[model samples]
Target: MTTSQNPTAQAPYKQLRRPTTDRMIAGVASGLGRYFDADPTLVRVIFAVVTVLTGGLAALTYPVIWFLMPEEPPTAPPWPTAATTAAPAAATTTPAPTMPVHGDRGPI
Candidate 1:
């Protein structure tokens, strides 16, 4: 008889993402305002007041939760941004004046 587990009552597996950078049409109210942390402009004003009191049928649940939400995967701008450390260092590969010379063609 030994049962007593309560280490912060486990609750850290949230995965409702959908944020390709503060989207407005398909981020699904900022991924449900960061999965219920709220304030994505209050879930876009509660989806514009439930699509104007359900007249637009609650805006059809925002395209059915943007087709069952699952997007957040584009984070790659911290190595050195500011146009990648102030840009200007990638210009050396010029060989394309319409180069396509195959003087041996026989394909019908």
Candidate 2:
């Protein structure tokens, strides 16, 4: 059935997912570019300009967006890839102990 014929039919909304590819900092611009149908470079340039014009407000907001926007889910590795299969030794190994932090130092 044609989309025009169905009143319930609607265009798919673009999700703001942080892509793993074409990322400089946190894939924010790349994901935004894909969602808004703009070039990643253009998005970056616009962000840079906004940051400068807004007295670093954009810079501060970027991190907020990075934290809010979820990273794109990892895709399954291709077949026959080394990462796809675990070695026998690796499977039998135990996790290493984490180093303890001292109060004298800054936040751990």
Q: Which candidate is the best by lDDT?
A: 2
Q: What tens digits encode model 2's per-residue C-alpha lDDT throughout 54-78?
A: 9998899889889999887556121
Q: Estimate each model's TM-score.
A: 0.28, 0.57
* C-alpha positional error of residue 81 in candidate 2 after TM-score superposition, expressed in Å: 26
Best by TM-score: 2
At residue 69, candidate 1 shows an lDDT of 89
Tens digits of lDDT, candidate 1, 1-108: 999966434335766878788778778888788778776888899889889988989888788889988887675222223465564655655666875468845565
lDDT of each: 0.73, 0.76
RMSD of 1: 13.6
* Model 2 bad stretches (over 4 Å): 1-12, 76-108
